[model samples]
Target: MISHVLIAIISVLLVAAYLAAVLAGNPVYSALSMGIAFFLTALLFVLLGAPFLAAVQVIIYVGAMLVLFLFIVMMFDLNKSSLTPVRFKPSTILSYFLIMLVLLTGFFVARSVVRMPSGFAITGFGSARNIGFNLMHYYLLPFELASFVLLVGVFGAIAFIKNRRGT
Candidate 1:
């Protein structure tokens, strides 16, 4: 009962933050709100009995990605006064409507798929060491790719800031 209530409250708060982030004019606020949503999601993972997933969510989403976004936003230091205000065109409206229609259609189609209930609580499959071994052994390529992406992002940020300084 308490768990459900807590989940509901946190979920609502996270959704509200996400919506505010999406609708806000300021990009910094959007990034901050996204960070909040990511942290809340980690909590949600904990509530769902996935401690490993929760830790990964925190480390990857909140720790790494949000930090990168914050740094990028800070480094860019965009001035709203200098930027032109973007206006929506009829084509943009039409595209958004079509996307929404497609999403709705997909959701309805997927609603007919079989649902499985989680069985009684069971201990996790492997210890953290075991999971690390599997990830390093089996999923090494994907892990390396992810690391490469992070490296690229860091270099890209540095390059952007350097170019700005040179200009």
Candidate 2:
């Protein structure tokens, strides 16, 4: 009862935060909204009995990643004089349409997970030990691939900054 209500509230908050992150015109506000979304996602993980995931989410993403993003945003020189008010552009409309499409697709995909089988047990499912075991054993390749992708992204960002500076 109360747990369900709390979940609903948190879910709403998470969606609102993400929406704000996407829609905000100011980069700093967008980053802050993303941080709020990440924190709420961590809270949701905790409520779902995945404390390890929640901790990782907060420590790695909300703490480290958001700070890095904020630092990068601050490092760039944004010209206030060149800034213009947001208008109803075709790309913006398309992006909103795509967002709705993805949301609906996700809802449909996850609708089946609302009911669990009677024989299924969820004990220690999201534990650090289980996660580590799975990461090291079964999902090692994908994990390494993701890390490589992130590395590429960091280099790409650095290159972009260098190009912008004409250095």
Candidate 3:
């Protein structure tokens, strides 16, 4: 009973943090909110009996990624006085509408296709050993592809910096 209540409270906090991240005008506030959201997500993973995932969420996302994001935002030297109010042009409004339409359609389609598993408790489901085995065996290609994508992004960023320096 306590666990369920804790989960519900953490979930509410997670949602609130996410909303704050999305709605915040200042980049720093947005990053901080996102960090809170990530931390709450990690707590949710722990509640679901996935300690490994929770650790990864806290270490990789909240620790590394959010720190990197905050660093980048700080490096940009954004001036609050220079920030202009968002103008919703017709094209922007239409694009947002179209994106929402697609997302809603996808949600409904996915809901029809996917069914929730009956069993909630799965021992060793998120263990490091099990995760390693599955990643190396079942999901090796996707994992490699993701690494390759990150490598490409790093290279692209380096090239962009070099070009900027040259110009």
Candidate 4:
């Protein structure tokens, strides 16, 4: 009971912090809030009995991705004057309404399916070795593609900061 309460409180705090991040004028604070949100998500993953996913979420997202975002934000030296003010229009309202409609439809559609539960069935090995084996066997192409995307991002960041000719 206590654990459930704590999880619920933390989840609410996480959402609040994410909203604060979005509204914050400072990029650095926004980055930190993003890190907090990622960490909270990792904790939730742990509570759900997926330790491997929790670790990956922390290491890859909170550790690497959020740190990278913070580094870039700091590297650019963004000032308050540089941050653009947000404006809401009729289109924005329409888009949000559409998103809510889709979400409600999904909830109703999923209700029937979620009630049916199959008997306990576990097949896949959750070990690192098994993960690597499957990745190499079936998911090799997509894995390679992701690596290529990372390489492109690396080069793109480097180029973004480089001095251009013909100033």
Q: What is the C-alpha RMSD of each candidate to the true structure, in Å?
A: 12.5, 11.4, 13.3, 12.7
- Indicate the worst ten consecutive residues by lDDT in candidate 1: 114-123
Model 4: CA > 4 A from native: 1-6, 76-127, 165-167
Task: In model 1, state the lDDT of residue 139.
Answer: 98
After superposition of all CA atoms, the RMSD between model 1 and the true structure is 12.5
Error of 1 at 77 (Å): 3.5
lDDT for 62 in candidate 2 is: 84
All candidates' lDDT scores?
0.76, 0.82, 0.82, 0.74
Q: Taking the tens digit of each residue's C-alpha lDDT, what string does model 3 give over 62-119?
A: 8899999999998997987957788989999999999999868855854565433434
Clashing pairs in 3: none
In model 2, residue pairs whose N, Cα or C atoms come closer than 3 Å (at least 3 residues apart or on different chains), thus clashing, are: none
Q: For each predicted model, how many residue pairs clash, with residues at least 3 apart or on different chains? A: 0, 0, 0, 0
Best by TM-score: 3
Residue 80 error for model 3, in Å?
A: 4.6
lDDT of 4: 0.74
- Report the lDDT tens digits of candidate 2 across residue range 1-167: 54476579789988899899999988988999999999889867866867679889999998899999999899999778757777999999999999999868745644543443433233467778878888999999999999999999999988876866478
Point out where model 1 deviates above 4 Å.
80-167
Deviation in Å, model 1, residue 156 alpha carbon: 8.6
